[model samples]
Target: MHKEEIVLLHLTLFHIKRLFEQAGIANGHFKLYDSLDVQPVHIHKSKADHKKAILMLCKGITEVFKETPPDEVLRNPKMKELLEVVG
Candidate 1:
């Protein structure tokens, strides 16, 4: 994907993460992401940095889903694969 595309994806996922947090559905799953101090709006950041942030966000999102409904999370093989690859 192009840099702009990745940034857009990063923005979307960042919003999803914030929504989960606001709804009290997310725990400290985003610790790694938070520690990175790189927001999606930071276009000055390198592509690789954004990529790392994206993975951390995905990991956190998967964890949040798993925490709320373990059975449902297991049903999605791809999500599990992503969690394994990202975590």
Candidate 2:
């Protein structure tokens, strides 16, 4: 996808993260994303950087909805590894 599209997606996810936080549903799952120090408004960032931020945000989202089924939660093994690497 184009860089602009990726940035837009990143922005949407960022807002969702904020909403989750305000609603007290957010946990510490955003640690990796916070470590990246990239925000949706940072349009100058590279496409790859935004992509990584998107992944981290998505990971955090998945984490918040703790009611997800076990099999589904275990599907993204790469995400677990990525979190470990970032941690």
* TM-score per candidate: 0.78, 0.75
Q: Which residue pairs collide, candidate 1?
A: none
Task: Give all candidate RMSDs, comma-separated.
Answer: 8.5, 10.8
Worst 10 residues of 2 by lDDT: 67-76
**Cα shift from native, residue 25, model 2 (Å):** 0.9
Please give, for residues 3-85, the per-residue lDDT of candidate 1 as tens digits: 89999999989987876665556779999999999898999999999999999999998988777785664455655555566
Candidate 1 stretches with Cα past 4 Å from truth are 70-87
**Residues 1-87 of candidate 2: C-alpha lDDT, one tens digit per residue:** 999999999999998787556544566879999999999999999999999999999999888776545455435465445435546
Provide the lDDT at 11 for model 2. 95
User: All candidates' lDDT scores?
Assistant: 0.83, 0.81
